[model samples]
Target: MGLAGLRIVLVEPAGPINVGSIARAMKNFGLQQLVLVNPQCDRLSVEALRMAVHAKEILESAVIVATLPEALQGCVRAVATTARVRDWEAPLENPRTALPWLIEQPTQPAALIFGREDRGLSNEELNYAQRFIRIPTSESYASLNLATAVAICCYELAQYAESPEIQTPQETELAPLELVESYYQQLESLLLNIGYLYPHTAASRMEKFRQIYNRTHLQTKEVTMLLGILRQVEWALKTPRKDEKL
Candidate 1:
């Protein structure tokens, strides 16, 4: 029960110092897997190296990817870190609610995603995650430094990772990312086709739907059920009967 194999992804990190600090903190908390997506600054720079100190190995071994999807390739579960409340996005939970599923799953890899230093993860990126985690902070300074947020989350994860209670029996199997994503895509297209959602307002409206379903943390069975319902509705709307009135 450790974060030794769990991946931590930083999307578009710009600060070398922050990168190094995160590596050091990861080492301190016993986390090893680090992933960076299209880094803006040299991740191996002197400033970063200096900050990493003895944890330079974590920095050196970090995988760099061209996009968020590539970084999340093999992860069974992924959580996104966000600061502000998204209008159409699902309600954000604390680290406690989200981390348990990760710790309990021994067979599949899990990922924790942190966004850029200047701006947090985009809605598209956030949509990729099954759960959203928000660190409680003062309203005046709701946004925390990227590294600080990472450290706090990492620490909380460490607590659960090291606990024996996290080894309990699994309750339900989560739907695969591909399956969930496909559902969203199909739902969006069906809605647009039926004029339920206009092209101009599709993204925001779809996001609200995403929030509602995601917040339920739907299992594979539930997802399949919903997909069936969506397909039926789509078919009914598209099929023309001879007796139907225009």
Candidate 2:
């Protein structure tokens, strides 16, 4: 369930031809799930259908959502593809090394997110993915078409699926994006209340924290522990207990 379990997420795709070609590539690699975030063109138009050919079902069945987070709701793992340099500390990884991390959890859903045809994914949009991958191209001509990037990543995913080492022992089950998001929201509110984060600069500061946690590959119990600490902070803020520092 490598490519099969991964959703090909396109954020604000403006071209029907690109979307249709991506759908066709997905079908070629045995990938069925496709999610579109705020698409700018008609995914079901005659243009899309013409490019999809025999893979028209993938185009027809694509899930259309309003935001990147909504596209990744239940997914436990996600890898975002980009050609630009990121402000975050995490190093950009190659597709072969990064993609297997997505399909490793057979029971859990995962995602491979691609950005817009023109501008690509913004920093905020990229925060939704735990891992980041960039395809190596000639420095003189580094631009890659939206569908071309998806085709490359989809091929890598298909290769991972066919390999015999698809399964491996795990330390713990990876936490879901929704669960991590809940922690982020609560943590942000608590930090703001304590004055650790200012209202104006909190968003940027919190992204640093997100980068730290995303690299940790946190498990379910770990998130629960951190949330427990936040909950204790919440309790202390309300009761103002004598032993604890507010």
Question: What TM-score would each prediction reach against the true structure?
Answer: 0.84, 0.94
Q: Candidate 1: worst 10 consecutive residues by lDDT?
A: 164-173
Off by over 4 Å in 1: 138-143, 221-246
Residue 108 of candidate 1: its Cα lDDT? 66
What value does the lDDT take at residue 124 in candidate 1? 86
Backbone collision count in every prediction? Answer: 0, 0
Indicate the residue-level lDDT of 53 in model 1: 95
lDDT of 1 by residue, 1-246 (tens): 338868899999999999999999999998999999999988799999999999999999999999998888766678898987877536688888787666576566778999988888998899888788889998787878888988998898888877766556654677776777778999998888888999999988888888787767667787799899999998888888779987
**Model 1 residue 98 distance off true place after TM-score fit, in angstroms:** 3.5
